[model samples]
Target: MYVRTSEVRGDPARLDEGLRLIREEIYPAVTAMDGCAGMSVLFDRNICRVVATTSWRSEDAMWASTETVRALRESAERALGGTGGSEVHQWEVAVAHHDHPVPDGAHARLTWMSCKPALIDRAVDLFRMVALPQIQEFDGFCGTTLMVDRGAGRIVGTAAVESRGAIESSRDAAAMIRERFSTELDATVDGVEEMEVAFAHLHVPEMV
Candidate 1:
């Protein structure tokens, strides 16, 4: 699958409007396209950012569909305070796995760890040795990123799984972490937030 991911930063006050537009307007345009598979949009109140992810059948198909929505795309750019507007980076979805339900070919899983400030290092070490290696070894495991926010005392690890089975069998991902990296018996996984894609479309195709 071909994937496109982008982050847009704007005034916190305007976030709700932005999200509404994405959900109500932008996404519909994409879902109607031929090659479009699925999309999800994430808004981080703590960080004041919106992340939009979409999957497509091919790079050429994505571009062909994109050309049909130039105006709507422009509005999103204006929303993000761009003159020429920003473009999303295209990525090859070599492998993806997730706990949440995904399309036939796509995969996704989000693991969250909540811990006290003191145990932050332990969490990082655990992820490095246990979690990372297991995900890396997966047949379609392409790459993974570990996000740490010391200011908020939050550590979030994101693993891009390679296939549907990899995402479905996430217990193994947790087991790997527990076996190799669980330094704090008290450390617990608070929740696994399911993700959804966000697509946008303008009311008038000609309106910018």
Candidate 2:
């Protein structure tokens, strides 16, 4: 599977409006497009960031719909009162797993990292084999997704849980796992943010 992420950092006060547009406008429009497999949105009020992700069945399918999504993406940024356009990225879905169907009111922690290009595959292996099992064992665990940009050596991962409190309690342990991964994989942890899973409608099959 492939994925595209459209991110906007905007005014915190307009979160609700942004989310409304995402859930009502962008979701339906994008999901209806050719070859779309799934779509999800992540919102963090503290940083005023919203990330919209759409998964595709193939590389061609993902690129084919880019232009059409451009307009809707800009509209989302405008709704958020964002000054500029969205930060966009294309990725390959490296790993995807869920304990159960996602429930309402789930929260997620997103981790961004970059490593040596050659280590990308190794990193994915470590994550899927070692890190993922530990993650699933956490109380309130829901699901996780890992996406990679091979050319850029960049990776973005999501760990969804039942609520904010669950994320808070798992902070230290999560940090330990993250630090270990970076050390082993020679990757730099770029940014980490906790966000609300505004919406998730996935059709991408589980990889693990």
Candidate 3:
């Protein structure tokens, strides 16, 4: 798996518009291309920063996909460059270590779900009480954890799953859970987006 991380900044008024374009135009083009495994996007309106990522089966496959997206790349370069706050980097998936083994032939989906600050506690609770049980039983289900930005009072749900199919299916599963938990755990869940990515392991060299 390979990681392509892009950092971007745009005018406040155009934030939502830019994100929409990336989701609808840029990402779909990349993900539908050959060799593309998975992808994820994250944005913070307060800070006007965005992080977009995607994974590929191999470095070759990644390049193959990008090679065909020349126009898109050029447009992004023009729109993103010289904005005084934009960058993109590519990295190899080097190493992965985990207390629990990932599912066979499985991939990871990193989602930065954001909702109203008032809904944070219940949102977390909803996942813990309702979402987890259902999601844990998914065939390709891996696991999930939350990263709460205390200062911002925003929550980030970072999840790892087996495949794109699993991520999509989880929605129905979550809906069922929501049906049960909505009364007690209803939240203004503005968005629950998904991104698939290859996980890379990073480790230090050992003594010879």
Weakest 10 consecutive residues of candidate 2 by summed lDDT: 199-208
TM-score of the candidate numbered 2? 0.97
lDDT of every predicted structure (CA atoms):
0.54, 0.89, 0.53
lDDT of 2 by residue, 22-101 (tens): 88878989999999998988888897899888999999999999899998988888889999856899999999998876
> Over 4 Å off in model 1, which ranges?
79-87, 102-208
Lowest lDDT 10-residue stretch of candidate 1: 199-208
Spell out the clash pairs found in candidate 3. Answer: 39-196, 95-201, 96-201
Model 3 over residues 119-163: C-alpha lDDT tens digits? 666666665666566556765665554444333444444445677
TM-score of 1: 0.49
Show model 2 residue runs off by greater than 4 Å. Answer: none
| C-alpha TM-scores of all predictions | 0.49, 0.97, 0.43
For model 2 the local lDDT of residue 146 reads 88
| Candidate numbers, best lDDT first, in rank order | 2, 1, 3
Ranking by TM-score: 2, 1, 3
lDDT of 2: 0.89
Looking at model 2, residue 35 earns an lDDT score of 95
Task: Compare the candidates by TM-score and give the number of the best one.
Answer: 2
Residue 117 local lDDT, model 1: 66
